[model samples]
Target: MSGSPALFDAHLHLRDARILPFHARYVKDALDVGVTACIDCATRPEEWAMEVSSSLAATTAYGLHPWYASVSVPNWLERLECVLASDPNAPVGEIGLDGIRRVHDGGTAQRAVLFAQLDLAARLGRPVILHGARVWPLLLRLLEPWADRICAWQLHGINFSHELLALPFFKRANAWFSVGGGLLKPAARLLPELLPHLPLNRLLVETDSPDRFPIGGDPLVLGQHQLLYNQPGNLRCILRAAATLRALPVDELAEQTAQNARDFLAAR
Candidate 1:
């Protein structure tokens, strides 16, 4: 965290040529720019190994995400167990409930799958990076018992305003919010209000990459609404934006967030 320091994108998705060509270039760009690390999220058993294989220097999480909500519980669990048995080092995560998205999942199914992953992680004594949307309340309810079991919990791609971050559970729990390109929106300045609501020690930055960007680099300021893309390289801009919002030096902002990521990883 001294000198130029390093940027660790807590969450990202980069598909290889065998899987998809678009993300290969994106991954190269991130590595070329010296991103410290990115956690490649696996959304299904078929894609779990790809997530682990895609990590050139970053890490990976094995489990089915919200999109596979309709995917039967036993099917995904078998795949998760296979990945775990093969790679005991791989963590189980990027799994949770989502009410905001149009995933073909039932509320009960989402809860069931998420709980199963948590149980698996607990047995393995590994950590997790959660993805909870409108179902935050439900997520907390299920995760309460295992609060100390997870290594980390990340709320991905959120545009949360200042007032919505007032949950007391977050203060007592072990989790962090991974803010993505949502901060690039025109009303981004409202982010300052969000900083005060959390434990302050538990905050992280991410691009969520390809999906968050979709288009290409457009800039977080004037072009926030230009439909620009998101990437690991853009995380620096996110750091800068956060620094400005908090009225702190850029280096300090980067250092603090880096520590937060470390703490999240180590706490598990």
Candidate 2:
């Protein structure tokens, strides 16, 4: 690993309350292993505030995740806009629709919030980090109108499908695909098989730390619940697994994905 390229976690939540108390250790461990950069995403307004106050060294992204969509305060949109406006380089997201969570109005609220943020990103010419679970088609349909307007889209934790590649969003040069520890699961046969088919320049990697802990991940202890939290250091394990699936040397893949991450983040 002496000559390995520094890794980039394209999407994660270092500002997450669950792991914030020990973020310094998590960041240090990640940096020691060559994860030189990370895009720390805030799922809601409070987390955004935490990002502003925290000392974590990361490129910050702000948005309301679907799970928190219905619970957002009245002035959340205005606050979100202010955060993005404060930093032009920052991306807008970790935002999208999730059908799995039972929201009051059957996802109507999620769509409304998602559109507002998407429109804001387009207006400000910022890239977006999107999350769509059990609502991929609806997300795609929602994105079509703004596909050309937004600078870039990081489809975080994507589940690959050949049909998805044919969509206008995927056809655009601005689209990026980020994969995480979920790809290491035995049941994720499709992702491994289709991994090579994804455009290399648009592919990125992440840990989604404090969640999505890899199959053989290096665990960070969570004392109260006795839970295993995923840390950024596990990116090395993910990179190695991805390299094997793609039949490329780990270093080669690391550099490629790192460059891809830089391009995605720097877009616009």
lDDT of 2: 0.83
1-268 in candidate 1: lDDT tens per residue?
A: 2467667787776542232544554556566655667777766766775633443456666777876767655566877888878866566768888876675435777778888888988887777778776666556666677776665566665555555454555555566777766666665554556765656577788877656662224322222343244567777777776677777787777777877867766655
Candidate 1: what lDDT? Answer: 0.66
lDDT of 2 by residue, 65-121 (tens): 999877849899999999888888899989998866677787888889999999889
What residue runs in model 2 are displaced by over 4 Å at the alpha carbon? 51-57, 222-226
Q: Which numbered prediction scores highest in lDDT against the true structure?
A: 2
The candidate that achieves the highest TM-score relative to the unseen native structure: 2
lDDT score, candidate 2, position 268: 91
- Tell me the lDDT of model 2 at 46: 84
| Clash count, candidate 2 | 0
| Worst 10-residue lDDT window, candidate 1 | 214-223
Candidate 1 at residue 176, lDDT?
Answer: 78
